[model samples]
Target: MPQAFPIFPLLSYDSRKNSMTEARNWADKKTLGGRGHFDLQSSPASLVLDSVRAGDEGLYRCRVDFKKSPTRNARTNLTVIIPPHAPTILTKEEGQPVWTMVGPYNEGESLTLTCQVDGGKPTPRVVWLMNGEVVDEKSETQGPQRVTNTLTLEKLTRSHLHAALVCQASNNNHSTPVQTIINIEMNCEFYVGFSCLKDNKRGMDKF
Candidate 1:
């Protein structure tokens, strides 16, 4: 006479119950309706995920039960990394807010600007660059999602006129850094008959 074997359903670890719970009785499509991202099959006994998001990052445990064999369990830790949004440049002139362009500032005047970005799984880092060289970078976390960096150029001179000031932000190396560019404009001076004439330098914005 042959002995009978009882069938068992596949299960998932339930943290609340501290035990295994049946997960759709091993491949019941209707049980997983509305969650199109999950795929559980019998042949390979694997779970697939699609279009993952930051909210899906966490610890997961799967348990498999068999009719005539020992149970199997697996654990996984998922981490989702999201890129940051484009940085924005902001400043003020004479107590008024300014964006993109900061001035027709007089020569030897001080200039200050702030770069800000929001949204990323890991907080983004903001930096300031001038002429392809890093000039200043001071970052602060306003909360879990926002980041800001400020740069100040004290005593702007004729050499700083039309210079490209770049504000860049990035949280990961896999993606290109988001950046904003602004140009520094200053008063230009000319000599005519021993008299110094001053005029505002004007042109297209530099990258």
Candidate 2:
């Protein structure tokens, strides 16, 4: 009977640093020390990350170099998932009567709706929607994790009445986003003492 020896392939793992160098070798089975947050294990060859952070999310590549055989390589991506908190909506008006009611506003006025989400890792994306349609808006990042998106409606008309304004916060980790919805209100001048009556009638008609 002949004794058999287990042949192991040399494994090395690298992360992209910049466009010039391609990838910098961060961990290898042969070397030790100065790995920071990266851990390398032998035998089967595996890489372990310790105390992952938001900045650590990126592409990673692993290479297996054999002495006489062809060199083999594999690539993978690492995404850090941090679900954001529930979105909050704030309404602001200039030089006009502010409507605190859920749904009522005067026409020919400008209103600002600010959507905010606080405390999320990897920075969540905030989106604004009007009547289920995506609204073009820019999101601003505050500190490390907070995000704010503002939408301004100019020259408000009765066409906006009963329309739903939604703010949603999402990340890759969450299947469903955290959202808040506000229904536009018709001005009292339009229909005296009939606030939300149309909504109720529409709901009843569905049944």
Candidate 3:
């Protein structure tokens, strides 16, 4: 959980204290046999990588075949995520969505909209927008999962048909804000017309 005491310029470690010329990799492989220079207690035996860099990552494993009992093996995943850079958002329609079937029914409805982002240092930022407004929630990346956010709206109406909803993903990696636009519409005449009409009526009554 904590960053293994990183003193860089030093990584090899040992359990015993002896006057030896610090060694890097152990040839034994079985136990990475303690050489003369193995750092004793100076650093952690196994490095705890909170976040890995791009260079060397992915699954790292070690296998041991002892002459006595059972064999042993272990693996660890090292993934690199670079933060996306804050890029320009031109007109908010650069990477906008283009609906299929050329229909308007899909425009309004109860919906759960979400956005997913990948690659970033210190993690990319993901935010949801409803009717061009921002929604609040903690943004975190689980494992190699790209940043993602979901916005849920219940019972849709015509006003939300062709409404401008946005999902913004940003980090230091990209030079522009990545946005995905959602244009929702309800196709059912009974649902859109009757429901939307009554919903608006309630608003007027409130005043």
Best by lDDT: 1
Q: TM-score of predicted model 2?
A: 0.50
The order of the candidates by TM-score, greatest first, is 1, 2, 3
> 1-113 in candidate 2: lDDT tens per residue?
53222243223344334442464444333422333332344555566665656655666665665556897867678788767888877765432322323446688776677
lDDT of each: 0.71, 0.66, 0.51
Tens digits of lDDT, candidate 3, 1-207: 643432332223332343345433443322222222333455533544333346545555544444466866566766665656332222222334343211244434456544556666656778867666786444657556466565666666666656776667776553666766655555755433333233475565321
- TM-score winner: 1
Instruction: Score candidate 3 by TM-score against the native.
Output: 0.40
Residue 172 in candidate 2, Cα distance off native in Å? 1.3
TM of each candidate vs. truth? 0.67, 0.50, 0.40
